[model samples]
Target chain A: MSGNNDYTQIDNLLREDRMPHIWCPGCGLGSVLHSFLTALNKSEVPLDKVSVVSGIGCTGRTAGYVKLDSFHTTHGRAIPFATGLKLANPELKVIVFSGDGDIGSIGGNHLIHAARRNMDLTVICVNNFIYGMTGGQVAPTTPLNARTSTSPYGCFDRPFNLPKLVTAAGATYVARWTAMHVRRLEKAIVEALLKPGFSFVEVIAPCPTQYGRKNRQSTGLAQMDYYKENSIIKHGADTKDVDIDLNGQIVIGKFVDIECPTFYDLQTEILGKTFPHMSKTQAEEASA
Target chain B: MSRDGQLVGEFFMNGDVASAEGAICAGCRFFAGYPITPATEVAERMAERLPEVGGTFIQMEDEIASMAAILGGSWGGVKSMTSTSGPGFSLMMENLGLGAMTETPCVVVNIQRAGPSTGLPTLTQQGDMMQARWGSHGLYGTIAIAPSSPQEMFELTITAFNLSEKYRTPVLIMSDESVGHMSEKVVIPPMEQIEIFPRRKPTVPVDEYLPFKADADLVPPMGNAGEGYRFHVTGLTHDERGYPDMTAEAQDKLVRRLLDKIELNKDDIIILEEDGIDGAEVVVCSYGISARVALLAVKAAREEGIKVGILRLVTVWPFPDQKIKEIAKKIRAFVVPELNAGQVVLEVERCAGGAAETILVPHMGGAVHDPDVILEAIRKGSK
Candidate 1:
């Protein structure tokens, strides 16, 4: 396989409509999409074998852009669609990309279920703190007291700690990185793609046009600077220490990793005992 | 002829068990269903027989999961099925559209009960006739079958599986509680005589295969997951490669084919049975449990010095319009008897071309219409 350094092939995989994305001039979503295409290109995972699934919102358009088998589904429902796709043809590499609104709010149940099932796929959630497509509405992952179209009185509800949520929901692999950490984000994407079970990487991207302007942050470039200043290099940070608000909060790194059996693996085990020699492999061969 | 020309088989069973036996005989090996009344027997029987035949059965969390799981199982290279009643079938609509858009082949058995919402769990009604055709939110077509007996349930279940595979669309087996709970003799066919429909597999090299590229037939050959024929699938209107493209042109092309694939070939997909009516002035059209009663009414009407014929719709959707039109010219009037207030009756009227007078004979939850009520409609239409 070719090395990751050559990004020329990645250009071929970028979607045309998704060309000038809706992200802020320097928004991390672009970097994430770039890194994603890079991983697929570098891994030489044939574009034909990949099926990208996304939900409604700005990031949801990734499905439309990706030059592969993609499902641009309804809001927050991308996981279920991806779950169906992966379960149907385990050979297809299923990846889900969406915004916080898509993943944490409408699709929250599917996220938890997919995590618990430990489905073999990758989930890339671009956390921009607020809904961008609906013109900066307060999102489920919006920071405490953040101002937005929906939360004029400031978001009173505490936002979700997404990594912690998935960790508790039984995701086998969890990682977090900011938009400015392009190399780290790209590596995470590559690792998640290779992981045999459910892998989640919550990329904290900056919506300079919406959240950044409302929160009184600098331009998109300056927001990238904040990500650089705030993030620490520790890979094993405690969940309690990672915080997105005032007082003491460390932007957490890799938190939990366990080896619980995935839904399909355990499913095949029960099936093997219940119906000996009825494995899908045998059935497919016989049918052929 | 064979030594046993009549061919012997008989058993007392409920509607759900009969449907499950039908699926098994049809070569269905993957089942995902959450237990619901009047439909639970189908799932239970699958749990028992699917294992014996080296097939798999899963109890999903809900009907939505059941629908999604079956879609997955189908793509995973198995003939998959799910059974539910009205409430569960209602929950399955969203994903049912998903199956339609993705063009996945699977069987969904709706053993209908009385309901606006769970009106009668143990009773029968055919209220979901329209839902079976248009419950999903989209412009896709559906193939629905209404079986009147345990024997037809077994036979049509196989036919549903075969049609679904042939067209790469979801097939609906709409059975009411009356037929689901009732039992009579159903012959179990010998293995050699049973006809099974397998989905078309890709014959081209793995690299050359495009999952959604249509051949002479609108259906492209499908490759099972994990078999190395890598292809993408999506819910968006997409090109033949299964990649999402956001353009009016793309949507127009894709949606047209999705609608045309079934519409253009309606003749190949529609199935109905006709009785009497060579020189009859009136005809009765019905399906499911009502068809059984209609059959009896047709017999009784003839004995009572009235000329009446029966038109039994084996395939409820694609709605048998051409057959109805042909019969309309021969008959002076049409009578449709159904468990619902009026569903298929409306379709019968629309397709009868204003030539035949169409009358609706409606029944509600848990109630089977008296044969005399249909006889009256026949009498009125005959005159």
Candidate 2:
């Protein structure tokens, strides 16, 4: 809390000294981080037992700012790192806070595999639609025909419908929200934090310096206005219908929430059946 | 058997299986690996044996995930390891840098095959020696041990784990296909006879702990993920508090300590075995499978009445520069033999510093060196 500005309520969870964060003036990463911290505060889980993991990007800096046992891992590898963390210490509540490019492109294999295994983790992905830190390159979530540093002629490639992708990949909980929907996003995060298996919440946020200015939404407020106009909250909507396009209707809601035995639960059950004398506690003690 | 049911007896096993057994004996309770040639047996063995020992074995999506997983497992307060070959090792380089920067303790085994890019999947090569040293993009020191046999693979994997724990850095066991697949008798000692080095834990309360604050030994005590010590770690240039400090000064302080932690302790970390070096005219310098071949050449040179000796490098990185320098001053010439075209020999030539003639016996590397080729180099070196 020893800093120039005094925001006492949120200061306990933030590394204020690392402030003057690297996000752009009109960027929405700050809002997403704030919502995450608030949701973390509201959850009953012990802060000391919670570990935050992030990959490389503007959003990845979230791990550095959080005052927890956080890991700022390699680009696209946060899910795997968090997977290891959760598997090694089942008592720990592991959360991955990264960006769409990191979780969808190079790290897509791990993302799908983790979901397929139904790993017990909460993943918060900020989809800015462009690679912000790398100067607005086309990202996997970049809408078709969106102008980018690499795609000056307007990108023609198909962007992934992440909600549909994760839902198909077997994520037990899936949701999407814009940064404009603060309360709703916070609530989604809280629910994801409480869920038992492979919970994913995608926050569609503004990258004013990157995706925004190029797409004519030059300010965060303008992007918020866009969300206010175009976003539709359809809870229980079919995940297949959640595709986003430029100036098109953006579907946002809690699309999936069901349950299955998590990776650990299944692993422990199989091991216990195999080794009759082996209980979870006995296994942990043996490891110790 | 130990509490983990690790067998305690001598048995014939390949280097990969022995490596897994060695890790289990060293108290490594977490393994994350992918299936790759000459190294997949390590993963297969772990998959079969880890469950019996109450350890966890996860076959990750790829080498990148495997490497990242072990780092995560290490932070969760377990000894963790991974095994891979050329392509997988290439995939692991980025996260290996992450492990070094974060100072996470883990072991990485590279059962190398000939490769510029998957050249020969089932053949032997010692080409990765340089990659093991400088593959990751950064200024950092590395610890890599080269094992010549199944016995050495078992013995040195345990050593790799111990060094990794003591230094809080990722240690590499660089075994080539020849050693990795070769079968030999390995003695698994009783649990009481083996040594295990656990990570140094913080003595202070959670409030007083700084995650990256180094002790006098330049290694910080680590805390587990869920032990109520909510500390932060990142791959960025960070301060001792483990918070990102994007400054030249912070980079200088942190990078220097990361390098110095291993570099300054080179004497304690480097392992070299020497024989018949008292006033020898020529010394055959080599490691891994090539070291065994070079030893046969040295013995052949002795039979031919030439004054030649052998200097085998067990710990290949930290590069035995001082030892080579000292030997270069006394020897007439050095014959360096390796499966690669010429990797570690370059180190010998550089460390020799023009004090002695250095000859490289290069093999294209589908197989071990012809002993007579090294013997011929020894004869020329003696001349």
DockQ of each: 0.30, 0.77
lDDT of 2 at A97: 97
Clashes of 2: 0
Question: Judged by DockQ, which candidate is best?
Answer: 2
For model 1, the local distance difference test gives 0.80
> lDDT tens digits, residues A1-288, model 1?
235568535655665644566555756677788888887776666556677778889899787666565666666767765676566556678889998999999878778878988888799999988899889998888888888989988889888888888888888888888878877778778878877678898988888888888887747887777777777766766555565771113374666566777666766667778665644442254357
How far is A230's C-alpha from truth in model 2 (Å)?
1.4
Write one digit per residue (lDDT tens) for candidate 2, span B1-383. Answer: 65668889999999999999999899888999999998999999999888898789999999999999999999998899999999999999999999999999999999999988988999988888899999999988899999999999998999999999899999999999999999999999998898888789999988898989999989999988988777888999998899888899999999999999998899999999999887999999999999898877888889999988789999999888889999999999999999988999999999999999999999987899999999999999999
For every model shown, what is its TM-score relative to the native structure? Answer: 0.88, 0.96
Query: Model 1: residues >4 Å from true position, as ranges?
Result: A3-24, A37-50, A67-69, A89-93, A190-196, A232-234, A237-243, A246-250, A278-288, B1-12, B202-210, B224-230, B243-249
What is the fraction of true interface contacts found in candidate 1?
0.29
Q: How many residue pairs clash in each candidate at the backbone level?
A: 3, 0
